[model samples]
Target chain A: MLGLSQQALLRLPWRRSLESIALPVIALTAALIIFGGFCAMAGANPFQVYGSIYKAAFGRWSAWQHTLILSAPLMLTALCTALPARLGLVIIGNEGALVMGGLAAMATGLGLGITLPPLMVQLAMAAAGMAAGGLWIMLAGALRYYRGVNETISSLLLNYIAIAIMNHLVEGPMRDASFVIKPSSAELDPANWLGAIPGSRIHFGLLYGLVVCLLAYVLIQRTPFGFAARIVGGNIRAARIAGLPVGKLTLAICFLGGSAAGLAGMVEVAAVQKRINQSLVSNYGYAGILVAFVSRHNPLATILAAILLGGILASGGILQRSHNLPDATVLVFQGIVFLCVLYSESLYGKFPCFREGEG
Target chain B: MAAESLGLWGIPLGILAGTLRGSAPFLFVSLGECLTEKSGKINLGLEGVLLMGAMSAYGVSYLSQDLVGDFWAPWLGVLAAGFSGMALGTIHGWVAQQPRVNDVATGIAMITLGSGLAFFFGKPFIQPQAPQLMTFDWGAWSSSPQVQAALKVSPLFLLGVAIAPLLYAFFRSTRWGLSIRAVGDSPQAARAMGISIFKVRLFSIMAGSFLAGIGGACLSLYYPGVWTERISSGQGLMAVALVIFAQWNPIQCLWASLLFGGAQAIGPTFQSVGIDSYYYLFNAAPYILTLIIMIITCSPQRTLSGSPGALGKSDHT
Candidate 1:
């Protein structure tokens, strides 16, 4: 039998929340210190390097716009991992879904041509992209739920296959003869291109990302479906005993998550690249995994995490130019952050201060 | 085209040679992953480990060639690659063993860390040439020059083939192997038997990573013979899927790796036949095949009999 104080120490709700936030914050600081040491070793002043990173990422309006541009796709892609995570599925195939989505969007746009209104064409593109992305991830979920295949490995393998398919289409059938230097589909008409926000270079994808993330937050935190998904995630056996449609929930969550990533691809095609190409398979999908992890799989938190990561990405060129750091310096920082965040998991619920109710 | 240079007989022979050549990396990586998974751990970071090993091997080989005589440089490079892999694996094993750490997430982090470290360190080793591992022409018996050239097999490939049986035997017969199996099947049982689960898993992960490092060395020092960022191109990840396809049996790993190697060889074979239209499609075949195999093998009705019971689960102890 435990004493009263021991029981209290184990029951502190606020303490758990505090420790969750504190541990990550501490880990972030530690990672920065370690990375600063790395920069110093590379013959750059650590303070100046950090200063440049800050300035380039957030100092000027233009820099802010660039960061926002980078953040938009990340916000959407992070949902691919974050949402399915609620169902205890680790889907890393968002890259595959994103590329497939982009391909679908491009194909739809090409098929629709100028016959439709620009707004209607964009909607069709988004629908096609979402549907394609949803189906791709649903396949992985179906494999996991029906075939018992591990989603992580299958999704990753699917990513490679998706990239291969993208390469085949772009280099073979979809190649625009005029663009021999870089194989790509024909560009979208300027009228159909995603317009910039008023007085800013940032596009409407940023708004879409924010709205989707908010909607996802509401869906997860304020809905019965989200409650059922959480229960399934907590314990599949119990969820099954409780008569939850475990398979349907898994499939649905995966489809929704995948659709978010698909929308990101659509955004990339309609809003930024304006054409499908190999570059559509950028590290944004991978980076989104990092973002989702850093946010602890919270959809709302993912927006903030994406912005932070986006700024870091936008600052890469400046770090290379001013500090003589390698182009991959940001990658090293990201790696450090990821490692620290993972290590920090050990600190949760173990802090003395977080222990319940002595006072 | 290089394939055109070889005739009809060369296409089948080319695939055979390619199977031997390409399967080396897969065999080593899958074997390593098998060892790790058998110890109740999964190190998805092997992709990054592969890249880092490739870079380290290339860097060491180039440096040793400049410092020491060329004769011992390649061997030294392979050793360095193995050590580097062990070091990274050590970090992963330690971090993952810590309380509350998620193995999958930790692996993802390690992937970034290893690849980032490699890219940063590998910038300088891009241009300088490193001594390549020696190869023997097994097809020397053939009258054609193309046959002889196509059958130029690296000693590493032969070594990989030989290791499969030895590893299978080790898992079946050795005391340490039994302990690893015990740990993987049930940590609670292993602990009751007075085994230190931590030590077994750590050592298994390190040893597995060492083998994976050797696989990377094969890529850089023998087959591709270059230090580049894209040298691995998800071969390590492919190896992970292959391990599952092989049902975690080392002998099956050998066969599965060859199957994958054959899939990879299809492109070059088609090119030899003057059908280069779907080259990217051929390159994509291995991944598609892996997915298909996984789909067919994975069944929800029953747990995979070959899976280590505790694989990927964080040990409370």
Candidate 2:
């Protein structure tokens, strides 16, 4: 028999990946148990509360529809984070871009004063939104490339600026004076409105988000651009030595990421809210970070993670109403899961058998 | 109108008031960050610390119903918030101290966790009628309402002012402070000199968190007197940026915070005057300015030379 250290080093590769996946699963289940205890403390039956949460989030047809609706924007916004992350750029400006995109869509729809078909209007809106977001993020990338400013702080700062800009437009110039309590842009005319999915609250936006995710997966996994981005992310000096257009790659990904997030704003305005408003943020940008983290920044994994998180978000309203659980409980769970997952990063590359045991 | 608002005259008065309101939180967060950075680690988790402070301070003030009578409430709430930061910071320090876990990742996780926990406890305190803390009326000298409004200095403002010079002195002149600074600048050198870098960083993060917690308390207890989901509103993050803008000098930090505060106040001032357009740009002015400043100052080949060498150094190897 092998010694204890040798045995510990002899774990299978499949087992390692399983453990990588299992850690989060275990953390989530443990969270449920802890939250269940919290539910019990708050004078609710844990079993019943959990049952209701599951039913409201994913068990029923209507709930599934809500899940899809929520997942659509999350998937796109998560791409805003994931794509930039591949280039080692921590761009948290997705919310800001989303707001700008929605504003762009609203401005274009109203400014042109043309009555177009729904699909045509959506296409136009998407293009407008994408362009706005693209420019916003490219500013950060440009600053980083040319000026040596840290992208994380600059991107985050830009996000604040973008939101402020949106708020100004909605509250000042672009506001439809007819509405009060919450300022908003003029509602998109009915001809420009996006249709709902056949069976539920799901919309054309979900399909768009999925297509983007698929496209991102293909781009990252297949393209020469993807290869260059990966090399740059792994090492900047090496990437430059390899004769790669490091600055161009960084700028392109940032633009693409920002556009994806901007599309979220576009879809929300055209297909869901039907107007540009302050509700554009709704912490979707922040939630997208959690979705990206849970998926470990993999584009394909982000889609699944978004669906899971969307379910939790959809269930939050139900939990608050039914079990007296605070709506922020979902946020708390996300925080815990995120922390646990990060802590579990220690597990990666630790097994000697998985590695070649080379120093 | 732009010319009327221009020159050193208009901006300074607005900046003074802004400094008073804005400096309180900056004083606490930067001081806390100073301490943490001195310990040779960074805690971007101050955002969560501020939120928790706001929630707990509001809850405490609401529970007591007398602002000054329950002056201890905010302190207690601050302590609670500090402990929360310490707990999270400790986990961060421990994990980062390990061979594998990245400091940036640890900080990000802590931020997420701290904010989540704050939101969780902050739920009940959202609607509480918080007792407002007393304000010092430095504006009483002015006859003009505009001048009066511009000069209404807060007690917390004065406190922040007093704290900056004191902290600057403490970090530069004191023995323990030197030790903290030594560890921050070079852990290898510190270890050679027999100082524990780990202990120094641990101490600094805890202290920085305490100050950040007090900043949060000031927001809820003194100025705003209410709690909401957006209570902190990235103030904690901006203050960290402000640290860089200040070139990591406490005195410079005082000026930077005031500049931001004035910029913040400009939006409301313009709104009050009914100059309706470009309000978004006005609101965004500070962040944009910050980005511009960051770009102008940060060198392409080398990092900012003025920073304490130990700040934000990743133990990646």
Candidate 3:
């Protein structure tokens, strides 16, 4: 009887997983249809617009390079939300952590001057960024665990505060004298700049993102700690009864997630911007939330979702130039996708095929 | 030396003026959120709603000025903003009621949708000059031109102030208000009492959204007096935090909003007095204040008595 019940449970999840995948796919298709209607209302043929988007984002070698570059940061930041989500915490202050991480990295680079070896300086910058980001997000976790503060609200408010702090530093005390037009820190020495891949325009950050996400996938799916975290997420009261270290797990997961986001900021500074400035606080943090949600908080799936979103963002300029549409037009598409995906959550477990004894 | 002292005194006076002017948007948004939360749903998407409202209000004011002249344009623009907010709120309410929909995630999506639609449609209105709402020169009694300029108050500001006590009375005395509170505190109990949870919550959300839209209109049609992509600047989000700080009391919201307004005014006030040091830090005061407030009020040891029991929780039934 035990073996039979176990077999039945195993069979049910396979069908359940199939439905989970099918529902989101359907939602995405519906969202695309709605987006197409909007485009048609704007006087552009929806098919032509989608075709141009595809051509611009993935059709050419140069386009692929751009998408890969954008995806690198997104993958890292998406982890920020995904990991915390495993503990049933919604942390959206990845932007704040990214900004602070970038600032910390920049400060470390400038503070070290040129005394250390180039590799050492780069390592130090990464460390600074990770530490800053980890602490910043950990504050939200701590607040939630200890103070009953809502992680979502606290983290988001922290984003505003972090940006303000960055602005204060960049525009005031840390302003580089020669960089008058835009207040920025002194650029990192050329020796410290992250090198691009030999055959492509994409840098080492893409590899870093993939490796980190893979490691995260392994940790979440294959570890005892992850098992405990899942238990906590499934039911906190039960987790307490089980004697699980819920507080410690929450803080550790939040820290790890925040460190990934911080590293993304460092990569943006070292590999792309080559300096820290106001531009570092781009919407990658917010976009990562969408990516995480689309991936259903799975680290492995986050990589694919990040790349897809990166391609959409990469096509914005092309849409503007070719279709006379504003760059923000894509935001409408993303918003629709987000809504449909959230709505699709209702469709899960309701499908007839997934019903017990159907097979 | 006398002029310097006068300038010093102007800082306080300027802050007082800023409190009255700046608190209007905060007051309206917080009250709106307050009403919604009282019905057991938190609409964090009000940030995006405010942005869309601002954009639509500006666009309508600009268009109506061309068609009907300035006399009626601003009021018509306010109406358009409220309508836009209601539409978005309806989407949120409907989605929230759907099975398995997470209110927080849905709220986030709504934010993206509202802001995306606003930005996509607002491009044309960026350069147009919309008719601005009129303001009363209450400072005319002062001899200083500086004081007179500082004291210019929009009529919307007065309306926001008046609405606070009215909302307090609404919650205290009205049947609908009691119904909303009942739905919020105990949905099972409310349902047993023959109340329709869906209708009460949905109508409450729509009404709250209308108030938030008025707040957005105040931002574009009065103070800043121009439509820009950044007009709302997270004021709607800040108002969410403000509602918590107010402990869900409408009257307390007035005091909390003024405090936030004062925090916002610090930067400009200091600048006017030639104290440019740490200006950006001063600009960050409101966010800092919000963080501090959340820390103080959100203690796990004590339950927040004013919080609606059902707020932010999914109703499995």
Evaluated on CA atoms against the true complex, candidate 1 attains a DockQ of 0.69
Candidate 1, residue B144: lDDT: 75
Which scores greater on lDDT, model 2 or model 3? 3
Clashing pairs in 1: none
What is the C-alpha lDDT profile of model 2 across A1-359, one tens digit per residue?
A: 46755755764455666666776676678767876876787688989887987888899888899998999999998888889888877777777878888889878877655566666777888899888887788888888888877776787787788888878878878889998869888888877776787766678899989999999988988998888898898888999998999889989998999899888888888888887787887878767866776677788989988998788778888778887777776666666656666666666666554453232
Work out the TM-score per prediction.
0.96, 0.88, 0.96
Specify the CAPRI tier of model 1: medium
Writing each residue's lDDT as its tens digit, candidate 1 over B263-290 gives 8988878877887779788988878887
DockQ (C-alpha based) per candidate is 0.69, 0.54, 0.70
**Residue ranges of candidate 3 with Cα displaced over 4 Å:** A1-10, B1-6
Clashing pairs in 2: B32-B208, B39-B201, B184-B310
**Candidates 1 and 3: which is better by DockQ?**
3
Q: Tens-digit lDDT track for model 3 on A28-92? A: 89998999999999999999998998887899999999999999999999998999999888888
RMSD of 3: 2.1
TM-score of model number 2: 0.88
Q: Write the per-residue lDDT of candidate 1 for residues A26-123, one digit (tens) a residue.
A: 99899899999998898889899889988988999999999999999999999999999988888898899899989998899888888999999988
